[model samples]
Target: MKFWQSVEHAVTPAHGWAATTGAVVAPVFHYFYGTGRADILVVLLVCTALDWVTGIQAAKKQDKTYSSEYGLSRLPRTMFFLALPALANLLDRVMATPGFLFYGVTFGLIYHTWNSLTANAHRAGWPVPKAIVNLVETEIKAKTERAMKQKEGK
Candidate 1:
């Protein structure tokens, strides 16, 4: 398949940027920091579980009804953690990039960890790290309660 087709096929909600961040990038970082391959898998699983728990928390906090779609979308993302190495190997063969698997894992772990941090901080009314804060301003001195007050006062 062509590159666009590959991207299109991969562009489901489950395989989108958020899931990649949570499953791939987060685990990749742990792997980079001297984690063994097996340990990296464990970390990926942990991060996926964390994603689910956080998703549930967010839904509950918002009083939103959970859908089967949400669960379905999440499953493939978790699976991507396991599949990425193989996929990267294939890509490596095709692109002549030797470290494709490593790149895949490292990027995925980094993405997920940063995403998790940002989401948790947002939920808690705190600021996430500037490195992954996206478009939001990073307010250093404002605690949760103060942020809430400032938000309400606005």
Candidate 2:
């Protein structure tokens, strides 16, 4: 067997798999986020990862065993995070709202995840400043209130 033939044999399957995955995933991503919004997803994913790491550290700090089951529990929450924005984007399109619902839902999820990350870091004995924590809580509260008011008005 020639060296180039072996190389092609090894790479071809991986390339096909990647291409197939991209074909499916790219359309779904564009459907949900359109264009120029992947940063939102990236940030949310990064925040979730940081939160997971901090949660593990926090569990260790408290002398608790971090279970794989607990880690796997994030799957549903992550799905919710993704689904909410997609739903909101659909609503925005239907309502002709120009990305308002999508951005709001995505940012809200990001903020919530950030809050969780900070709490986990604090639990892990990190010196998470009180002011930062308070600000997050305050913004969450304000957003909630505003949303409630909007709902009431409607």
Candidate 3:
């Protein structure tokens, strides 16, 4: 339910705290602030537990059961996430500043996250574009319905 846990649930459904933090959060902080590697590790441990709970919710919603195999599959997802920070670091060193590295890596993560999400959605037999459109439509419907209900109540 925490911020990082939410991020993990969004990006890698089966990810845990240790892998997410160690691969994603710690590296980001280490590159950005140049301190608190230890803090990152500890926080990730807690977030991993939180990820499991959220993963369960996600699995139930999708009508699938949880398994250790699924959790372990997130290892590759963690590696993919980690690549951005590593590239950022290398670019920072070569470019003599963090600007390009930071933005480039940020965008890379965004793009990769979207691509992965779309792929997973497709694999789950939810047509990607239609699913996105449905989500948007659903949001609009909810908002409109809420407003109408409020008006009637008033």
Q: Which predicted model would earn the best TM-score?
A: 2
Which of candidates 1 and 3 reaches a greater lDDT?
A: 1
Q: Which run of 10 residues does model 2 get worst, by summed lDDT?
A: 139-148
Model 3 error, position 53 (Å)? 5.5
Better of 2 and 3 by TM-score: 2
Over 90-130, each residue of candidate 2 has an lDDT whose tens digit, in order, gives 89989999899999988998888888777667666788888
- Once superposed on the true structure, which residue ranges of model 3 sit more than 4 Å away at CA? 1-55, 110-154
- TM-score per model over all chains: 0.45, 0.73, 0.38
Q: Candidate 1 lDDT, tens digit per residue, 1-107? A: 69999989879987677886878776665443333455555666666676667655544443244456655876787676656755665566567776656567656
User: Considering only N, C-alpha and C atoms within 3 Å, which residue pairs clash in candidate 3?
Assistant: 16-48, 17-48
Instruction: Go through the candidates in order and give the C-alpha RMSD of each one to the true structure.
Output: 15.8, 8.7, 17.0
Q: Is 1 or 2 the stronger prediction by lDDT?
A: 2
- Model 1, position 121, has a per-residue lDDT of 50
Of the pair 1 and 2, which is ahead by TM-score? 2
Name the candidate, 2 or 3, with the larger lDDT value: 2
Candidate 2 Cα lDDT to native: 0.77
Q: Rank the candidates by lDDT, best first.
A: 2, 1, 3
Tens digits of per-residue lDDT, candidate 3, 16-115, equal 5567667887666666434433443344334444444544444444435545665688778765555555566667767888556655665565554444
